[model samples]
Target: MSEPLYHVSANPHVRDNGSTQKIMLDVIIALLPATIFGIYIFGAPAAKTIVITIVTCVAAEYIYQKLMKQPVTISDMSAALTGLLLALNLPPEVPFWLPIIGGVFAIIVVKQLFGGLGQNFMNPALGARCFLLISFAARMSAFTYDGVTTATPLASLKAGESVDVLRMFEGFIPGTIGETSAILLIIGGIYLVARKVISPIIPCVYIATVAVFVTLFGGHGVDIQYIAAHLFGGGLMLGAIFMATDYVTSPITNKGKVIYGIVLGILTGLFRLFGPMAEGVSYSIIIANILVPLIEKVTMPTPFGIVKGGKSNE
Candidate 1:
């Protein structure tokens, strides 16, 4: 075929080699270790939560679309991912109906109502997680591990108790379903970075900032265990790696991402140290998601061959 005169077109004239299905599939693979580890730690109840969340989320999306005369797109796996992430953020012992409510809100109100998939302004799972956290603080905060109520390491720290660092690193402690295992979460994060499904800068900066902040101002000053517990004891790893790095909700520019991560890290530190809540990752990520559009706007790169005042830079 011969080249034709340049034709005018709308946006997205070019497409990447990746598809929505392939990207979502990679996310599923990355999340598998943490999801399975969560189930293993929490046992059958955890399994039930996971299955209920996935089914409810997928069904909500399908049914809403069919009723509204829109094409059903649950095959893309976005709803499944949302459900899984929301479940991971929940205490394993929550009522099964909780995930069902969260699933409906996530898909119908958070995702589909905002134009679905790529159009949503915030991370659906984190939004649902925050919603649940607020409305059901009693249930969401009461964590049970091995049939006993336990404060998460962060909460224990706030209560002036020391935690076993090794158990925290492993998956032996109680918290949310997916956030207890720092090792498994790190491995999954590495896989996603290797597969190029996500950039490492966000998680790295977020975690590093938390480490540095706690190390500098942890009151005891420079204690390794103090910093480690703050880093590995809660949802920082899970939120930074999975939810905060969401394509639709996160900044598109590299610089914007770094700044966003820094903001999250600082906000998290403030909340952990001063705020009443023990875990700040969920709140930090949700707040950052809301600011993404503004971050992108400010960090937006100047057009090629264009300079300030509309002059050519070239």
Candidate 2:
């Protein structure tokens, strides 16, 4: 009798490295420094706001998924990250309930409604932020901390007033918790970049483009150095590094990434200069998110040896 032939079937493939859980964990770790800095700058209220935002976001995600009969994904920590980011983007003195509402919008509407994980069209936290900005402009614009109200860096800059560069770096300014200190945000961003958690293309190109645009305009007797200051002020670093680089919302192709970055920068500059609001990072990123698919299609690489009609080689 002939020996039976032996064959190994390779059908299903499974990939295991780090999960969404792990990636989210790393992101949370990367954000820790800024969180600590925020607490230090804004004191106990900042901590309270952070906690409330996180709990509300997680609760919203859990409730929404449970209601839809989808397996609750809170273990992935994505909701927590979204909550943390939303909190960071908010004024330290914001009412506690506002972030809860934003979180509901983020997890329920922007994230899960379109399909959970990997399927959302835009960054949930940023989308929620944009929504909140439009819905509650008064609350969003009322900047305060520890009972002291002040204009944001962008507002001051636009008003032809000056900011103390040293104080801004030290997080003494009144703005969003994680956005006030350019130095701390850069440090955290660098760590994320070094860990290969995020690409530098967006942040570097975005900031540079803004700098160039502001320089070219040269309005109100602002110089290049002043333009540079604007680059580090407000939420530019946070949005460029975190929100704009959101994997699901950003372009996949290299050329597309550059286009995305450039467009965001230009829009941010235009809004800062001409729009009613002084800060524009959230709006700019959301706009870029909306265009990512189109950008990817336009910038897609040509398929090898394939003509428009799929003609064969001559």
Steric clashes per prediction: 0, 0
Model 2 weakest 10-residue run by lDDT = 8-17
Q: Tell me the spans in candidate 2 whose CA falls farther than 4 Å from its real position.
A: 1-16, 220-222, 309-314
TM-score for each candidate, following the candidate numbering:
0.94, 0.91
* Candidate 1 segments exceeding 4 Å error: 1-15, 309-314
Per-residue lDDT tens digits for candidate 2, residues 1-314, read 89999865321111446567777887888888889989898887789878888898899989988888888889989899999999898877778788888989988899888887777888888888888888988888887755788788778888888867677766777888788877778888888788777778888889888888787774844574587668878899889887887878887677888889999999999998878778889989988888988998889877887766668555
lDDT of each: 0.88, 0.82
Best by lDDT: 1
Residue pairs that clash (backbone atoms under 3 angstroms), model 2: none
